[model samples]
Target: MAGTSTGVLMAELTTTARATRVIAAVVGVALLLAGTVWGQDDKFPFGPFSMYAGVNGPNEPAPDTRVEGTDSTGRVIVLAERNAGVRRAEIEGQEGAYVDDPSRLARIADSYQRLNPGAPPLVKVALIVREHEIHNSSATGRWWDDVRAVWDRPA
Candidate 1:
């Protein structure tokens, strides 16, 4: 009788495990389908596969974004990951938001100050975009900076 009960319990557990796996797989597939249909960069992981989905036309300029600051001594500083503790990709991803409200850049300035205590305090921060001139889908070694937004430190 004991042996029969143990065998029955094992069979029941196996059935439950199989059902759980099937349910999980179905949910995963549903999320993938939904994300593919209606996801953007913000909805990453399951989002649309769009990092390289779009192609640029030959002879069109390619945008390169960077963050820069004007210090108290009037020296320009590039705020890269090492100095500012923020990555360029993070800034580029939210370029539109910064353009809409330049004041948001103050956070970056604060971060820069926190990381580099001896450096001159930033007087101004700006989001600049350099469009690299391209020809035949190749870089022409020419570019121009377009200042999208500037945030001046308050007195």
Candidate 2:
């Protein structure tokens, strides 16, 4: 009688576990479908990955944005994540805000100085967008820099 009761309890637990899994799977699928239909980049894991979903024309110039700083020593430094602790994607995502408010770029320079204490202080910071000339869906080894925003320290 004891052995039969134990077996029945195990079977019930297994059945419960299976039902829970099914419900979770159904909810996950529903969320994914809904996210795909109406989600933006901020929705992340459930949303359609917009970066991969985007398409560029074969002959369109591809934009590559970067932050550049002119230090006191008169050297132009490319402030990448390694140097400035700011990612290119982060800058690109807020391109418009930087354009609207150029002073915001001073924050990036401050970030760079904080990360590299020994380095020369940045006197000028500029947000540059380099458009690589594309032909037949490939780079043509030609590009132009568009200075979108500039932040100069008060000397």
Q: Report the backbone clash tally of model 1.
A: 0
Query: Each model's TM-score?
Result: 0.71, 0.75
* Global fold similarity of model 1 (TM-score): 0.71
Q: Which residue runs does candidate 2 get wrong by more than 4 Å?
A: 1-13, 23-43, 46-48
**Candidate 1 residue lDDT tens string, 31-119:** 88888899765576667756457777999899889999999999999999999988776788789999999999999999999999999
- The candidate that achieves the highest TM-score relative to the unseen native structure: 2
Summarize candidate 2's per-residue lDDT along 58-110 as a digit string, tens digits: 99999889899999999999999999988886788789999999999999999
Clashing pairs for model 1 are none
RMSD of each: 6.4, 5.8
Worst 10 residues of 1 by lDDT: 1-10
